[model samples]
Target: MTSILIADPIPLLNKGEQALLEGIVESLNIIFSKPDIMLLSNYPEKDARRSRIPVINRNPVLFKSIKKIMPRSAFLLEGALMAILARFGKQNFRRLFTRSELWQAFLNSDIIVVGHDSSVSYDAVIIGWLLNKPLVIFAGSIELFRNKLKESIAKVLLKKVNLITLREDDSYKALMDLGVIPGVKTQVTADAAFLLKPCSPERVKEITQQEDLPVHDRPKVGVTLTRQMCERSHQEINDVNERYKKAIAEKAIVLDEIIERYNVEIVFFPHCIGPGKNDDRLVARDVIQLMKRKDMVKPVVSDLGASELKGLIGQQCEVFIGERTHSVIAAMSQGIPSICITFPSDRRTHGIIGGMICQRDFIYNVERLNPIELLTLVDKLWAERPVIRKKLEGIIPLVKERALNSARLIQTIVSEKEKSDNGYRCPSSQH
Candidate 1:
């Protein structure tokens, strides 16, 4: 059996990352008969249960542990310290690649698929080198580096991957601008989550029953906002504490207006349920508190798996407005109209993805995040839901095909490696 290990899946906390892992695994299962798969995550039990794969819990490296101990305000300082340490030599870098669980899983696997949804930090590339294995940067996006020192480190590590497939044109350009090495098999593909099929109807019924979610007669609007993005905006903008306050407060007002005009029920989907600031449930509730019609807004904070959450969104929501890329993806894949709200420095993932289905009608930057403008956009999108759904119906399948191609590319790469090891074709070829 071919053993494949997925690194940095982070399935439990963030639903978008979960969708990517599941989409890839689903493709793998179709091509390979019962391949051995292992996932690495911080929340092993939750991830394993959700993905239906054995998982190894990855421990934080010394630097990461130290960084975590510091207050969030010092994140920039921690990043600088890490960059300085990384520039010192490979010894500092190798210290991060020596986790026991990560090493054990890498040794047991034939191929490594690194998630690109997060930043390209080069940890997986280093681990791949230690095991002398080929690795792929799965369907994800990367930012164009503004810092030269970090860019140097990123370029060196990114080039080591066996294959690099990015989700959008902007990310592809970012990789090129960062200087990808020649002869590295690189291509542009849609995000793996774009291929995500909803959960079974039976499972959907089970979830709705267990959660006791109301079956609203009016249109249901699904919403998700990430606390991380809001906090990051706080750091980036000037006198923005008031602006951030207004953004959330204004969001509530917009929703109220939307409810009044369209008679829609708002359902808040908290994709990240991790500890501390990562808990989106808190943000969802806070937004509800700011709303005028609190009775019309409901928060779904249950520990639902990614597909189940997507299934719920697909089944109940007439339209979605989410800061989380995956929540919007879940909505769009099911032909639900969506509006993706992105902040500054967002690698253009939201704009590119939303444009594929709804043109620019559904993509909004958070810079102009105000009640009046948002209400206008929401009204326009709700009015255009039929046309938007029609566009999504045509686009989603093509995106899925592109996502599955990543898996096929992996098979071809592994097959060629085995062929070169022996004079004849590999024995596994017939399967």
Candidate 2:
């Protein structure tokens, strides 16, 4: 059996990340016959419970435990010492520290796939490179690094990857700017989340009824928000918090106008619930508290999975105003018109919504958020919703095809590797 190790520390709380993981897994299942898959996780026990696939900690258990009590300098020293031991220690010495399991998993896997955009995935890429494992970065959105050191490191790491499938044209262009050319090694694809299947209509209805979301009584307008809108700004800590409060207040005003003018129920989808201040639920609560019409607004606080949440958005919403990329993608995939609220430097929005979906005009930068402008755009979307929906229907299939193309490319890489290793060709190649 072919073994594949996914080096993403899957955060189950964030629905967007969960959607990416599920879509990638679903796509892989179509290409490989029950491939033995393992995941490296920060919350290994929780992730193991959530997913059927085996999960392992990114670091050894003892080191992780020791990290809590050790001082920062000591911890760094210990980490360096452990690395040397793992690399050069005698077999029994390494076995004594339980370093074998982590190293063995990396050594045994045929390929390592990175599905996240964070530093955790970059660390995995470095390790996989050192081990000489086939590496594929799937559906990533790469942006130009503002830091020279980071840019240099990214250039080095990305240049060596077997395949790098980007989710947006901006990312592909960014790679080009960094001298990573578009060839056999690099290609543009759509986000993996586009292939994630939503829950059934029956399930969506059940969720609506369970959450008391008045989806049946009125036209529902789905909205998503995140704290990053303020945090990502080039401001000091104090300024960021103050700006966040102002942004939330402005959003409340916008939602109030949207509700009164359009006679629609505002459903707040907290796409990322939290590990910290990044929680959308807290932001939604603040927005709700500041709004005049609390009865017209409902925040989804239930623990719905990514697909289930996508089902609710796609099935119940007439129009979506989303800050989360995946939430907007969900609405778009189902032919629902959406306005994307994005951070100033978020290339994913510019690339996907602007370039692929052809809805560049609907994207609003949160840093320069104007209620009047947003309301005008919302009015336009409401007026032309039928046309917008029709346009999306025609466009979504092609985007989905592009999304699935990443999976086909993965299959090709795996098949070619297998053929070279075993001197046997794949059945698909026979045709």
Which of the numbered candidates is closest to the native, going by highest TM-score?
Answer: 2
| Candidate number of the best lDDT | 2
TM-score of each: 0.84, 0.87
- Residues 1-431 of candidate 1 have per-residue lDDT tens digits of 88788865565667777777778788888777789888877677767777677888664343466556764423334333333333343654534433345554554566778656755536665655544567888776777667989889888878778888777777777777777845578887677777667889889888878777768588799999876555544344576466557567777778888889988888888887876777788888878898889988888879777888999998889999888888888988888888888764665555356444545667777765666777788888888889888988898888888878788888887797676632111122322
| Candidate 2 residue pairs in backbone clash | none
How many clashing pairs in candidate 2? 0
Model 2 segments more than 4 A misplaced: 62-101, 118-120, 182-184, 230-238, 422-431
The superposed Cα distance between candidate 1 and the true structure at residue 413, in angstroms, equals 0.6
lDDT of the candidates, in the order given: 0.72, 0.78
In candidate 1, stretches whose alpha carbon ends up further than 4 angstroms from where it belongs are: 9-11, 60-102, 229-241, 422-431
